[model samples]
Target: MDAHSAPLPAAAMPANGFGRFAGHLDRALGGLVETVAALLVVVEIVILGAGVMARYVFHAPLVWSDELASILFLWLSMLGAVVALRRGEHMRMTGLVSRVSPQTRALLEAVAITASIAFL
Candidate 1:
């Protein structure tokens, strides 16, 4: 068969052992991150809305709402970052990287990944 039409070898398929378990774990973690991030955003919105209503309608501002909302927002942002990283959607210099050769691009990507891990 032509190279372009050839079927992939058995080895090219997904793993059937520990690799499969790892894939499941990765998917579970990703789902958890997305759920937590979405929940935090909802909480932040509700808290802020409550605070606004308390101040204007009830004439009683929620003293703790701002602090709680800020904390939730921080958590939401961190979780969102995790989700973005997992989805390969985190911010990067893609415009510059796209101009480089494949080898250089790979090296740059490795360096970026290492730096990200170190920063984390």
Candidate 2:
């Protein structure tokens, strides 16, 4: 292949050095977030179930159970959202995006992201 057609060397590629480091950091954080989210779901289930059992079956309601659940639910939800964002699973108007040309689609995505950030 001619020089122009040849693939760039690893050292010369854009995705090396800091880009590669950032990619690895992103994957590591994503995996950690996913694992934490999954664990939170399980813990929440267990806490709620035990709380119910303690209240109904044993005739002694756990006074702090609801408060604990509320706090955990908030954390779990945030972690779940983080996982979704990292995995690109957040809500999107895919039908609208899919119908557009590539250039338009890119522009639409950029606009969507900017709007989301600004709204935040």
Best by TM-score: 1
Query: Which residue runs does candidate 1 get wrong by more than 4 Å?
Result: 1-14
Q: Candidate 1 lDDT, tens digit per residue, 1-114?
A: 222224457587588888778778988988988988888888899999999999999999999999999989888888888887776777878778878887887888799889
Candidate 2 lDDT over 68-117, as tens digits, reads: 98999999878887776665666778778778787887788788779878
Instruction: Pull out the clashing pairs in model 1.
Output: none
TM-score of 2: 0.78
Candidate 2: clashing pairs of residues: none
- For every model shown, the clashing-pair count is 0, 0
Question: Per-model C-alpha lDDT, please?
Answer: 0.82, 0.78
Q: lDDT score, residue 81, model 2?
A: 71
